[model samples]
Target: MRPRILIVDDEPQIHRFLAPALTAAGYDPLRADDGASGLKGIAVWSPDAVVLDLGLPDMDGKAVLEQARAFYDGPIIILSARDREIEKIDSLDRGANDYVEKPFGVGELLARLRVALRQRQRFPGGETVIRAGGVEIDLERRLVRRDGEIVKVSPREYDLLSRLAQGHGKVLTHKELLVSVWGPAHVHDTQYLRVFIGQLRQKLETDPAHPKLILTEAGVGYRFYSP
Candidate 1:
């Protein structure tokens, strides 16, 4: 079956430009110009992945993401104009998997979407355990342990940490983390990411204020610092 892709943005030009690209890349396109309508479309269409813009009318794109996560478990690619470092981190923290800045290349967006789809397909049979930095994540069992000690983490927080650790010190931009974790609808909610990262620090870091594991990339996104 051809993958279904939803594009949620307020700009008509976005649909015009991306719809054709998505179609050419073997995806059925569903377009929404606002967050509320986008959420409804997501529930009804249940696309395989989403391309969401952070700046939307009615609600911030992040709220749409929070609502979507209540049911959907697909990839979300954030398409936003926000260029600040913190803004990108915020989106990733909220559970987005990947993000793209505005005026982005269609090729890059499509390529990342393909990557997200591929990753999701690989996890279909409930074999979910990730190990890195002395941390072990049994996603199917909802358990994380370091050096034989179990660590408690919220669902979203664990997802974030897992993705970062999986990257293994590779720099993931805010958009990339957001789309991968949160489902594309929240590629711009930096505040949400900030709060959760803080919580994660408290639980995992020896000093939450001076973290060493979940390392920041200055102006990009967060990464796992393997020692």
Candidate 2:
């Protein structure tokens, strides 16, 4: 069966443009103009994937994303005008699989959708083993290796690395990382996250000063750019 793609956007033109593109790509396109309708459609149609917009007339798109995540396990790609790094991080950390800013090319949007779907199929219930460049992380076994050599890391370091790796190219905010690794009380501890990120880069990057894998998004957070 053709994959069903639900597009939740407030703009009518988006539907007009995406419906044909999804059809041409051999997928069934479904539309919802607001968060309420989007949530309803998700419940009724049970689409294979979702293309969501952050701005909805009835509610914020992030709320829709959170609601969808409550019961839906399928991939969700956010299409929004919010280009701020923090917004992108918030959406990803909240459960969005991908984010595409507005004024985006149709080709890029389609490509991102394809990638999210492919990743979903490739790693179903989350990736247990992530291989990027020469680094291999077996989450289940709690093992880390680089260049065919086992790499030793503290329990906290491993926790930090796992959180970054799980983001899958999504930027993670400092608060999000701190909360995930050091618990809720550490959410405001930016220094702690920075120190650990520095350590992670030193271990994972070929050059810690000019990192290629673990990247700092300047005032935002970090993204694990997997190969």
Locate the minimum summed-lDDT window of 10 residues in model 2. 118-127
lDDT of 2 by residue, 77-187 (tens): 899999998898888779877778898888998887776676556666656898789998899999999998989889999999988888776667777788889999988
Determine the backbone clash count of candidate 2.
Answer: 0
> Candidate 2 — what's its lDDT?
0.86
lDDT of 1 by residue, 164-187 (tens): 766644457667777778878998
Give lDDT: candidate 1, residue 14. Answer: 91
TM of each candidate vs. truth:
0.63, 0.84
Q: Whole-model lDDT for model 1 versus the true structure?
A: 0.80
Q: Report lDDT (Cα) of residue 171, candidate 2.
A: 62
RMSD of 1: 8.8
State the C-alpha lDDT per candidate: 0.80, 0.86
Flag regions of model 1 displaced more than 4 Å.
Answer: 128-227
